[model samples]
Target: MGIKIIKRQGQTFKDKLFIPAIMGGMKTTLGHFTKNLKDVSNLTTIQYPEEQPTDVATNPRYRGVHRLTKWEDESEKCVACYMCATACPAECIFIDAEERFDGKAEKRPKEFKIDLLECVYCGYCVEACPCDAIRMDTGILSFTGSSREEFVVDKKYLMNNERAKDLSND
Candidate 1:
């Protein structure tokens, strides 16, 4: 008679273990599915504008909006140092430095324009400010423009925002 090898028919230890494990995994997934459908945990969403989250204020070092700070005389805090421009990964900050009238010791930006369209909100400019003139605290997360030209914000526009004025609270 030819040698006959019988194939393993019954469930082996690995097979038995794997089947239960799969069933357990499926059960866990189904549990999650049912829980998700109910959503009693209140962990999935935010109330947005009405119930503004406390995460930003809680995190003191958190960077939010971009602000072009001003001096006591209401002049720009920016010395036209160009550090922000250099630090930008998106290359969005553009400055035109000019000596103040009557010849001040420091140069000032005659034309400080930031292309918001190109800005990645990386907060590099805020960090690069040596004079603490520029900050990310206006809390402006969204901006819209009718045209590309409108998106290129000038110094006046950045410093003149209503939200920025609220920062002073005077």
Candidate 2:
């Protein structure tokens, strides 16, 4: 599709007054203020590290850590297409491919690594996989690492990122 430019209109008397805008902003703010005033549970912050996360994300659509899914026979689902690396805006995924000995046309990833430091957690990589190999529904919200090296996780680690059992139930 070609770019279309719309004509701009100059500010009118109502726009210049700012009272209506201010009132509208206040209405939105007061709505949230009253909502939070009724519900105090949302304001409680869990002290992380010292206090382990009691509740992980409950949303099924929640995207947290990445996981490399497997086939019915426990074979890797990734075909080493590199679409994930190509789709990644942050360029955090690195994969090395080798021909599969099982007489498959698609090659397997000899080595796969993802740098959490560079990852934006946008989930584009999961979307780019044609085999439905990668997913971000692990429910492991809080990932930690003391060093940059620890943040750069490999295929083995990604393969182990199973969804929490409690989260898997619902």
Candidate 3:
């Protein structure tokens, strides 16, 4: 005649309400389907080739292309400084220094090349340049080539033509 307090274990609240939950999910799914079908023209995806989305580089500080600057005299402002080469993590930059005809032996890179295929574009070279002769601000986004050799950019190609004027101005 004593009431036994047995713990209720079988068929919890979730199991008891399964039918209602399933009906609710089905209703929401059907609602979404009807809404999508009603306004198919309102879809946000753009047709890539026909309508290219403008590349919006939101960050001004983003590192993209590398530019070699010169002093106002238009001479190579590089002074053959090896800081960039030493700082490069990938060891992509190679520089060959030479003594100028002038009695003062200013370091001048006879051959400077950067293997774009190996470069990480980390802007480490730009930061390491003591003369402010290098910068990653060319605004050039992409470089394309069929082979590895084509991707290797030489100093003549990377050096800014206007850099000499900039050097002279300095």
**C-alpha lDDT values of all predictions:** 0.76, 0.85, 0.73
Task: List clashing residue pairs in candidate 2.
Answer: none
How well does each candidate superpose onto the true structure, as a TM-score?
A: 0.66, 0.69, 0.62
TM-score of 2: 0.69
Evaluate candidate 3 by giving its C-alpha RMSD to the native, one decimal.
9.2
Task: Report the C-alpha displacement of residue 87, candidate 3, in angstroms.
Answer: 0.8
Cα lDDT of model 3 by residue, 1-170, tens digit? 89999887547877687877799999999999999999998777867556634342224565665667765565667778799999999999999998776533366878888898889989899889988877766655566789889887777877752322112222
**Of candidates 3 and 1, the better by TM-score:** 1
After best superposition, candidate 2 residue 62: deviation in angstroms? 1.2
Q: Between candidates 2 and 3, name the one with more favorable lDDT.
A: 2
The worst-scoring run of ten residues by lDDT in candidate 3 lies at 161-170
Q: Which residues of candidate 2, in runs, are more than 4 Å off?
A: 1-45, 50-56, 103-105, 168-170
In model 1, which regions exceed 4 Å deviation? 1-30, 39-58, 102-105, 162-170
RMSD after Cα superposition, model 2: 6.5
Error of 2 at 96 (Å): 0.3
Q: What is every candidate's alpha-carbon RMSD to the true fold?
A: 8.7, 6.5, 9.2
Cα lDDT tens digits for candidate 1, 1-170: 89999897547887766887799999999998888889867565777765665555435455555668776677887889999999999999999999876343378999998888888888888878888777776655456668999888889987875343334342
